[model samples]
Target: MADRAGSGTPISFRGIEKRFGGVSALSPVTLDIEPGEFLTLLGPSGSGKTTLLNIVAGLVEPSAGQLWFGEQEVTDLPARERGVGMVFQNYALMPHLSVFENIAFPLRVRKISRADIAVRVKEVLQLVGMLSLADRRPRQLSGGQQQRVSIARCLVYKPSIVLMDEPLGALDKKLRMQLQLEIKRLHEQLGFTALYVTHDQDEAMSMSDRICLMDGGRTVQISEPTELYFRPQSSFAAGFLGEANLFEATLVQQNGHAFLEGAGGLRLGPAPEGARPGSRRTALLRPENVRVLATDESAENEAIGQVSEVAFFGGDTRLTVTLPSGMSLVIRGSTGHGLVKSGRGETLRIGWCDSAVTALPEQSA
Candidate 1:
C-alpha cells in the first residue's frame, strides 16, 4: 500500500500574501516545499503559519501570489479540486461511522468500487497499525487512536500534499512524542510531502526535515534543526528555538581580530564574518555550551559566580549561576558524573569555548 502511494510532488509559493481587508495576516511569502520532504511551519500564534497552510489547502484565498503544485498552478483551484489532505488539532471523525467506513469515505466519494474501497481502507488501516480495530467508532477510540483514524481517512485518498495543523496537540507528552516518530515513519515509508504547522519547537525539531520559522506574520528563518538551534542568524530565531544567553555586545578589534564585548565585559571572539567593528552586535550562547569548570581548569571565556538555582532532572542538571556583574547564566548538562557538584549559595566557575559563541544578525541600539 505504501509503495503504491508514489513519490511526493513538490509545491512552491510565489509571493503569497494574505490580508483580511485592512489587517495583514501574512506578508509576501515565497517558499518552496521540496518533494517528499517533511517541512514544519513553526512559530507562535498569529505568525501566519495557519493562514499560509489554509492557502495551500485552498481553505483561505491569498490576497496576492500564486501557488504551484508541481507543474500545475492551483492558486485559483477549488479546495475540493486540489489534491490536499488535512488532519486537524481535534480529531474530525464521523462518530457514527466505524474506522473502516471513516477511512473509506473519501474513496467512496470518488465513486470507487466497493471492492477497491475495502482493499484500500484495509491496506491503510494495516499501515497505520489499526487494522484490528477497523470496526471501532470515533467515540470508542482514545484521542491518539482517533487522530490515527483521522490520518487514515486522509491517506485513503492518496493526496499529493498532507497538511497537518497540530494534529498531536491534543495528546499527552509521552503520546505526542510517540506519534511524532510514528508520523515521521509514515511520511518516509509512504513518501508523501508533509506540511505541518506547530508552535512547539521540540516537536518541530524532532520531526521536520527543515523548519520554516515565522514571526510577526512573516518568515523569520528556515533551516535544518541543528543549524537553526546552534547558528541561528536572527535574535528571535536564537531565543525561540531554545534557551539562549543573548547579549547586545559592542564590537572590539585587537591585533586585527574581531571581538564582541558583551554585558559584564564578556568578550567573545573571533567574531563571525560580516561583523562590523565598533558596532553593536548580538551574541548567542546556548546553555549546553556552558561548562562547569574546576578551579584549576580554564576555558576561553571564564566567569565565576554563585549558584543561584539548581534543578535536577534525572541524569542531567540545570544550574543558574549569578555572576559578579549580576548577570545570570544558565548551564545544562549531565552533572551527575561530576561536571558540577555545587549547590545554591555555593560559588562555581563556569566557562565555554570561544568558538562556541556565535553572532546573530546584528541589531542597532
Candidate 2:
C-alpha cells in the first residue's frame, strides 16, 4: 500500500484564466488543494468547472496562470510528464482489450517489464474488487463495472493526483449512489489528492471535503458542505445548493434588532448581523427551516399564507404556501402520523427563527 500522508505534493493554481476568442471561459481564479484532500468543483453547465479540470489535466492550456505541483512549476509540462491520473465520464476502455489489458495498458506504454505489469494489474484489480472479471471485455461489463475498471486503470500507475470529470453521470441513480460510496472509501484508503467536477449538488455534498462553487466563469464561494448550506455568502450559492424562499426586501431599521419591509406591506424581523439598514437585500430561508404553526402560537418571524399545494414524499411532506403578498414559501415536515394536515386553500401560519434567514445582496429579476 502507498504511504497515505507522506505521498506527494499538493496542487496549486494561481491567477488561472482561460478565454476563447472574445469570450472568457474562466476568469482569474486561484486555489490550493491539500495533499490527500477531495475537493469538488461544483456548478452548472458552462460554469468553467470542466475547463479548469481540463487545464489541470493538460487537456487544455490556460490562457494565463501558473500551475504548481508542490514546489515544481508544471504550467508548461505535458500531460504524460505531469503524472496525473484522469477518469472520464464515459468509460473509454478499448473494446477489444480484456479488463486486465485495459488496466495494464498504462504500464505497457511505459515499457514496464511484463512480470511487473502483471503484478501491478492484479493489485489494482484487487484494490477495486474487480479481480474476478479480469477476463471480461468492456462490452461484457455493466456501467458500474466499467467505471470501476476505469478507476482501477487510473490508479494502477500510482499518480499523485486524480481528476474525475463527472465519472458517475452515466449510471442510474441507485448505481450512482453505490459507486459514490465506493469511490469515497477508495479515496480514504488510497489517500490520493483528487479534484472532481460535477453539477450535481448531492454528489458534491456527499463526497467532497470542500466545494468550489462557480457561476459565469467566476468562483462564487469555496467552503465545506455545512457552511455552504447553512451560511451561504451569496443568493446564487443558497439557491443553487438547495430549495430556498427568496424575498426582495429593504432594510427598514436597526436598533437592538433589524427590520425589513417587503412588497404588499409585509414586515419581517431583523436581518442577521452585517446586513445594513436601508440597503436593498434579499432574504433566503430554506424549506426545511420554515415551519407551519397554529394560529394562536407566536413565532419570532411569522407570516399568514394559504396552502397552495401539498406533496407527500416518503420521508417528508412539502407544502407550498402563498403569502397574502403573493410570495410563495415551501415548508418541510416529517411524514409521520400526526403530521400537520394541510391542503390547498387552507389558511396557514408560517414561521422561522431569526437565525434561519441569510440576507444577500439583491439581484435583478
Candidate 3:
C-alpha cells in the first residue's frame, strides 16, 4: 500500500474562469483541495462542475487565472504531462486487450520494463480484487467488473491525483452502491488526491470529504455534506442539496425575538439570526424537521394546513400540506404503527422549533 498521508499534492485554483465565445461556462472561482483528500464536484447538468474538473485535469485551460499542483505551476501543462490518472463513465477499456494488458497499458507507455509492469499490474489487480480475472477481455466481464478494471488501470500507475467522471453512472443501483463502497475503500487505502464529478447527491455526500456545489456557471457553496444539508448558505444551496420548504417573508423584530411574517396569515416565530426587521428574506424548512401536532398541543412554531398529498416510502411517510395562505410544505415522519394517519384534504396541524428554520438571503439573478 502507498503512504496514505504523503502520496498526493494539494491543488489550488486561483480565480479560474472559462468562457466560450461570448458566454461564460464557468465563472471566476477559487478553491483549495487538501492533499490526499477526496473532493467531489456536485451539481446538476450545465452547472459547470464538469468544466471545472476538466480544468483541473488539464483537458481544458482556464481563460483566466492560474492553477497549481503543490509547488508546480501547471497552467500551461498538457493532459499527458500532468501525471494525473483519469477514469471515465464508459470504463474506457480497450475491448481487444485482456484485463492484465489494459492495466499495464499506462506503464508500457512510460517504457517500463516487462518485469516491472508484471509486478505493478499484479499489485493493482489484487488491490481491486480482480487478479483472478486478469486474462478476461472487456467483453467478458460484467459492468461492475469492467469498472473495477478501469479503476485498477488508473491506480496501477500510482498517480498522485486521480479524476473520476461519473465512474459508476452506467451500473445498476445495487451495483453502483456496491462500487461506491469499493471505491471509498480503495481511496482510503491508496490516499491519492481525488477529484470526482457526479450529479447524484447521495453519491457525493457518501464519498466526499468535502463537496463543492455549482449552479448556473458559478460556485454556490463548498463545505462538508452535513453542513451543506443543515446550514446551507444560499437559497439555491438549501433547495438543491435536499428537500426544502421555502417561504418568502419579511423580518420583524419582536419584543425579544425575531419573527418571519409572510402573506396570508403565514408566520414563523423566532427567526434565525442576522435578519433585520423589514428586510425581505427566505426561510428553508426541511421536511424531517417539521412534525405533525395534536390539535390541543402548542409548540414554538405551528401551522394549520390541509393535506394535499401523502406518500409512503417504506421507511417514512411524506405529507404535502397546503396552508390557507396557498403555499405548500412537505413533512416527513416515521411510518410506525398508527403514525402519520392524516389523509388528503384533512386539516393537519404541523409544528417545529425555531432552530429548524434556516434564514437565507433572497436568491438573486
Write candidate 2's Cα lDDT for 1-365 as tens digits: 22358364599999999999999999999999888888899999999999999999998999999999999998989988989999999989999999999999999998999999999999999988999999999999999999999999999999889999999999999999999999989888888899999999999999998999999999999999888988788888988998888788888764665677677756655765676677777777788887777657777888889988989887889989998878888988787732357888998777888778777655521
**Model 1: per-residue lDDT, tens digit, 34-55?**
8888899999999999999999
Reference-based lDDT, each prediction:
0.88, 0.87, 0.88
lDDT of 3: 0.88
**Model 2 root-mean-square deviation:** 2.9
Clash count, one per candidate: 0, 1, 0
Look at candidate 3 and tell me the lDDT of residue 178: 93
Which is the leading candidate under TM-score?
1
Which is better, 2 or 3, measured by lDDT? 3
- Per-residue error at 188 for model 1, in Å? 0.6
TM-score order of candidates, top first: 1, 3, 2
